[model samples]
Target: MIENNRIKYSLAGFFMGVAELIPGISGATVAVIFKIYPNLMTILSKLRIKHLSFSLSSLSKKFQFDLLLPLIFSMIAAIILCSKAINFLLNNYEENFLTFLGCLMIILSLQIINFFKGILHQKKLFIFIFLGTSIGFILGQLDVESENISIFYLILSGVLAFSFFLIPGISGSSMLVVLGIYSPIIGAIANFNFDILIPFALGCLISLLLLPRLILSIYSSYEQSLLYLFSGLIASSGLLLL
Candidate 1:
């Protein structure tokens, strides 16, 4: 049973990595599809100095080191390794690639709608949905040329991507594309360009470190609004893909 569970975890990591590779997919969305979204977010939230100390202690060592460590590390490794191949594919087959992404976004949007059914007040949420959709549509249409690498922008990307990770249906990768950082990051990985990678990595680390608490706070205080906003964002994102 333990061995089987390990295999399941590994498969989950692989799928999540694949999602991260795609320009319009999110690793967090893959986690949701696999029914492990909550667990992933919970683990990320616990990544702090106090949690590290607790994890090092004998009592928490088994849970932290044995299970969580392997799962998270494997996922990160898989994403890094798969990214190059995905970039190649995207470059070669842009149309087909985008079609697949559009379909996936549609499915995700439906899932968001189903998730909010019977709980949220639709009337109250529609306006937010409209606004989100408008913003997404406008953002999708605008294109920007890449600028010289900046540590500040890298950190900002991390924060924005991390926030998207917590939001259901919104793909962090898609957000990266809109912000014009997706290709550069992929290129850095493909070529082992540390000059571009180190700052981006730092940004991702900081954002992930800080995101959990913010997510938890929002979930605790404004659960309905959060869900509604996420649903809207997802719907808008799907439209953008189309």
Candidate 2:
């Protein structure tokens, strides 16, 4: 039997939190890469909010709360602690950062393309690529200048970000950036502003609780097409970054 280690949980949570901070980096991808995503998802899938006491009792029977609590707390702490540093880098070196991000995005997209294993014919790929380019160009051109957003928008941003959190190649932070709330959200974290964090965190929690099962259901039905579509999106996001 493996001995329980709080240190391991702390490290896992820290890395996952770091992954969450980076635009185009998914916490789910980090977990999957680290070989913990399957079990983590299995655990999350079993969580129920039907009743606080009953849920806790049932969860205690199947999951290690001591181990999980540390990981969860650590991730939250890391996200809060790291936000200031990430904000600094993004604010000061945005051009260079975008360049690096663009390259990384292209590389990730290429990996997905290969994952298809010659499944996408040249003609189909051309079409998807064209569509991707068009969508990316449009999104890139759109001005996200408004920083004075409402709480509802922040929650919505959280929903969108967390919805993409499960998709291996998708980055929730990148989505937040695209939505123009990334800077403000990070600022809120750094300044300890709960007004925005409350709604945003709620959205994330809700999505984390609900979205994975839906995504799995969808993937079960359209795995190949979904992969192709996501590949195109990743390719486009890379173009937009440049």
Candidate 3:
């Protein structure tokens, strides 16, 4: 039974990891499709490694290693294997990739719109719309051309990029590309540079702790407005990429 559960999770993780590798493919969307979105988010959001004994005990009892370890390991394995292939595709088929990605983003934005019936009634809806669009547009425009990046900047990039990964339609890898760290990060992964990945991973962990809770709160309280704002961001991100 445990083996069966582990296999299921490993497969889920493989799918999520593959989605994470491709630019504009949202891992969160994959998780949602697999019906593990809420539970996975909750587990990661509340993860506390400092209390290792209690945390591990609780996780084993409630979440089950079969459902957690295999998924985590599988994702790490997939990322390591897929990074080079994704990089190759991005380099060779940039235009076609962007075109497909733009259409996907627009479609995802429409799906977000369908989630809210009375989005117009949300207070400051226009402000959120404007804010989201402006943010995406600015990110799309700014190009960090050099790979001589500082550790602080890498951590910041991870925090910002990974935070967006929690959003259903937003892709973290695409965010890294937009931020101009994608190539360097991919190179680092290929070369096995611990310096580049450690800070970024730490940042990712920190954001995982905070963003999920914040998202759940807003989702529960202002689902309409949040969806509206996210739709704008996702649409702009995709359109500008193209």
Of models 1 and 3, which has the larger lDDT?
3
lDDT of 2 by residue, 130-184 (tens): 5655655565455565458888887888898887677655578777877888788
Clashes per model (N, Cα, C within 3 A): 0, 0, 0
Quantify all predictions' global Cα lDDT against the true fold. 0.67, 0.70, 0.74
Which ranges of candidate 1 are over 4 A from the true structure? Answer: 1-11, 54-70, 73-93, 113-122
lDDT of 1 by residue, 1-242 (tens): 76766666677778777776665566666665565656666667777776544435663552344556556677888877887777787799877777777777766755754645734646776665666666666756767556885878877776777677665655677667877888887798889998777877787788788887777676667655655565555666665555
* Candidate with the larger lDDT of 1 and 2: 2
TM-score of each: 0.75, 0.66, 0.73
- Tell me model 1's lDDT, rounded to 2 decimals: 0.67
Name the top TM-score candidate. Answer: 1
> In candidate 1, where is summed lDDT lowest over 10 consecutive residues?
54-63
Clashing pairs in 3: none
lDDT of 3 by residue, 1-242 (tens): 86776777788788789878776667776665565666777666555655356566766865556588888898899888987877787899988877887887777666756635455455567676677677767766766664578889889888978987887556798778877898878888879898999998888887887788777766668756666676677778678757
